[model samples]
Target chain A: MELFTPDFGLIFWMFLSFAVLFFILWKFAWPAITKMIDQRAELIDKGVEYAQQARQDLDQAQAKAEEVMQEARRQQADILREADRVKTQIIEEARGEARQAAAKELDQAKLQIDQARKEAEQNIRDEVSAFALNIAQKVVRNQMSDTKAQTQLVDSLLDEIEKKN
Target chain B: MKRLTLIALLLISTLVSMSFPAAASTKGEDHGGEEKIDPKEIIFEHLGDRYGWEVPFCHHKSIPLPIIVFGSDGLHIFSSARVEHGKEYVDGGKIFRIAAEGDFKGKIVEIVDGEETRPFDISITKNVFALILTVIVVCLVLLPLRCYYRRKGYKAPRRWLGAVEALTAFIYDGVIKSTLKDKASKFAPYLLTVFYFIFVMNLMGLMVVFPGGANLTGNIAVTLVLAILTFLVTNIFGTKHYWKEIFWPDVPLWLKFPLPIMPIIEIFGVFTKPAALTVRLFANMMGGHMIVIVLTLLIFIFAQMGMAVAGGTAVISTMFSIFMLLIDVLVSFIQAYVFTMLSTIFISLAQENPHKEHGAAEAKH
Candidate 1:
């Protein structure tokens, strides 16, 4: 078999087809394809923007959670402080009442003691005057009776008075 | 009266020149004084008797061009068609010799040796001229259409641009971008050129009945060269991945345990892929052309038998030829697409990075 060969005629035709096709396609088809690609790219950009928005929303949610946790912490501290203040006030009120009751009881006891002391003094003085008068009457009635026995009684009575003083 | 006399003398000379056979100069041999052979017989003997075939061949009678001969002496350049007395007539205006012969001009030199020469003269052939004219027609018609739109102050209708645009979009979306992944646009111009080149050539081949005698695409050499170019471009523009896949394929250790053998086989597979592309395109074009030629030959063969038999066979063969012709038209477009598609596939394969797949698999491992 003779080896097939391409001639000038074939080459010319090939070149002609190439040139014409390239020119026509470049003018007509390329723009549409490029446009389609651009549209696709725009869609991808939109998708990316949406993804970014979602990410931002997530971050905002995280920050809000953090703020709520901080507020809870502050509220907890306030409750703890109020509880501490209330506890101190209750303790102070109890102490103030205890002091007032103790003072009132002391005042009543002093009044009672003063009254008893006065009573006792009066009783002692009256008893002492009666005894003295009785003694004088008795002396005038029985002037010459037993001088030695009277002297012995007076000495025992002196010893009792010294112990009482 | 003077002027009228000169006009009459000029007309008479023109008539006389038309009647007389023009003297032709002989190139290789000199027949000084032998009975002249008829110009028609010489042409018939050279083209028909020698080649075992005859085609209706004609050219502008004004220009006498040299006859091209492929013989044992390689391509023997003759001055012109043999007229009479072993003399040839070459046209002055049309004939011009180029240094290039066949396709490979610079690389492979044509070796000529003295041997028994079977001199056969195949004329320019109407089909060859028609093929050339088709290219011219395409350029003449489409170039102006392109320019009319491109020219300042001229706005072509949307439909006109739309038609051209559709083809461009098809090439870009269908062929180039689909083929060359990263640099589709980079090679879009080339791919587009190739697509349209094959498309137009195939289209011209389809229109052979109009002016051209045979389908130019049917020539195996044309398809082969195109396949070779695709092969070269695919390999030349191949990526690192392309080579890596072939040289060091990703396979199980057990499968590749034969060490050097597996690598060699893989490398061979890479070469065969492009080779298959070459063979496929050449085979398809050649097969299509051969079928058409055979169909046409049947007409001639039947006519050789008896007239009645010839008439009946002619009808059947012509019908079949027409059917084949329609299919051949479809085949032209299909072959062009197949060639382009295979070219794209080969290039895509070449540009693929085997390492990427290997890395992904390794990550899983």
Candidate 2:
């Protein structure tokens, strides 16, 4: 019964003090604490959002770098193929020039050979005709007196002509 | 080796010293005198409110508090020490004494014509001092939380203030926000204050020393006031729909019209919520403290058998009391949480959707 009984003095003081405490807490403390909490939550959310945005930007940069590298490699391959084609064309032109020069040289040598052959043939005919004319004159002068002596002289002249030729 | 021997000797001496309260009985019996110690008085004395603060291990030494009361003759103010030992104080030919028993037991009463009558006592009692101490502690803890938010803004506070922040967020988010939703912000201060107030009082009552053991929350008077505060918050801020639901509930006509049984039950339920709140907190804390005191009383009970038996029982009793005190700490937090949760639920019930009115009216058509 004593435990169940509530003293009026206690009730009076409790009511008074509790009411005062409630007023102070409601007016002063609560607003600031709750505001700070909400602010912190907002700040955290913003931080997470910014991090995600940064990661996305980094991914985009990486992809762009990969694309640039692929383009550069394609350009490099084009330049190498162009260089290879130019080298083959230059080599083909040089081979054609060399073949034309060799053909011209061969044709000039053939013309020189033909001229030398004609000149040699002309010199041979002149020498043979000169030797024939000289032998004929000697035979005619020596063999004027006797027929047997003229025949002998003519045969000797003929033998001399054969040796000279 | 020498230190080990010394340590063992110290342990034996401490255990022997711990058994002295039980050993005192035999010493009394050997002198051919039986000292009868009343366990009920010890338990109730510890639980009851006092005019003076009791000093530990000293029956006579106490801190006197101011006693203020209004008698039939007008207001009277004096020190409670004047009436400490059943002594009568005469002021202006009016005598006052602290009554020992009867209807006005443990109250400051005025003697007139040999009949004891209680004055209107507004004196600061032990429970009141504990209440003031609790209030001061709550302020000390809560004021810093507000300052941390004010000075540092959104950053978390360190140490004990950090614990306070977490507890506040827990009750705000877990209990109030979950139940009351948008109105959580409006009632946060009152609900949060009550939460800290009850928790501090419950924890302080668990302590066995001064400024700690006044049993403030365990006192029926204190819990009654707290419940009344919650009751006032619920009804005072109740929405129109809440009253409509109570008076003209959406049930069948026969229940509310002819019998009015539903309305009666609804009105009865409004009072019972606070009643349940009051009894639940008071009984849990009071029972915890009583159990610890009973376990300590076992030492005196077992002392009647023998000194060795009392020593053994004292060890067992101390162990159990420690265990009980540890469990009471958990119960303290749980009771505080439950009280705040129930208060939040009741407040939300009052703040039930204003949109319900349109739906109910439409349903009638």
Candidate 3:
């Protein structure tokens, strides 16, 4: 019963102390602590969110770089193929022109050779007839100088002519 | 760390000074006679309030405090030292003495015509002094932190600030947050103050010597006020649903219709919680101190009985007292934790939405 009995003095003191403490703490201490904790958490969350966005941006940039590289590679292949085609076409045109010029030159040389051979054949014919005519005039002059020889030659000629007639 | 070491040195110096005076007085009194050790006197004196902080083992040397009394004569104030121990003193028209042999024994009272007159004793007692000291220590530990917080709202805490921050965060996260859920931040300051106050007092009580010893939490008046504060806080912030559940509980219709039996029980339940809080804290703390005192008393009891028994008892008593002191340290921490935990739980229960249960059941169906 004595223990249960309240001491008003102690109660008054405890209440006064507690009230002052609670007021000062609530005013200055707790608010600062809680706010700082909350602000720190928010800052950490923001940092993590920013890091995640940066990682995503890095991935997007890498993908764009790969796309550009692939496009460049494809364009390079097309350019190389067009260059190979042009080179082959130029080589073919050069070969075709050389073949046509060689064929024309061969044809002209063949005509000139044909004309030279005909002219030589005519000149040989003429020289050979003139020699034969000289040889016949010499034979006529020898035969007139020698009548008998000439008559013999004439008789032989007449006989060959009569036989022909 | 440095400050704590300084405080430790101060406490040690005070203990040394206290013992020297006590030893000198006891030696002087030894030639007169052997003092008969009364265990009850030791226990009760330790538990009860004092007008002055008694220097351990010393007679006629105590730190007197101010006494404030309210009576038919309005208010009277004086130094408690004015009232001689076990003797009466006449001051102006009133005689003040310490009651020594009755129901009001150990109390400071006003004597009129040889009868003890009951004037309202609203003086600064041992417990009041302790409470004041606790406030000073708390303010000393916390007020300096305002500067650090004022500069940066939320950076890393260091030194004493770090220690206080950890404790505050623990109360916020562990007890208040776990109990109150959403309203934890709203009630954090009150709960944190209560926790630190009780913890400091509990630890101070464990000191058991002048300038440090004051069984503040063990004192029923102190615990009562604390419990009452918890009670007021719970009921004041109680929601409509809380009141509904208490007055018109969701019980069987017959239980409600007959005489509001459940409501009566529920309403009674409200006072019982704080009552339990008051008694539990009071009894545990008081009991711990009593056990330690009694264990030490064994040595004196055996000394009075026989020389051989006293010699053996001193060793056993010292060992048991040491063990009890260790347990007292642990008990102080546990009791503080329990009180704060229960207070938070009570407040949270008062704010609980009673309809949420029925809503959940309906949803499940």
Number of the predicted model whose DockQ against the real structure is largest: 2
Candidate 3 structure quality by residue, lDDT tens digits, B174-276: 8888777779887877887888888888888889687577878889988999999999999999999889888887789889887889899989989999999
Interface DockQ of each model: 0.06, 0.50, 0.45
Please rank every candidate by lDDT, starting with the best.
2, 3, 1
Best by TM-score: 2
- lDDT per residue for candidate 2 within A75-117, as digits (tens), equals 9999999999999999999999999999999999999999999
Mark the regions of model 3 whose C-alpha exceeds 4 Å error after superposition. A42-165, B1-31, B56-59, B305-312, B358-365
Give lDDT tens digits, candidate 1, residues B121-165.
343433344445655654554454444444522232257545654
lDDT of 3 at B281: 95
Name the TM-score of chain A in model 1: 0.49
RMSD per prediction, one decimal?
A: 20.2, 7.2, 6.8
List where candidate 2 sits over 4 angstroms from the true fold.
A79-165, B1-17, B22-33, B354-365
Global CA lDDT computed for model 1: 0.55
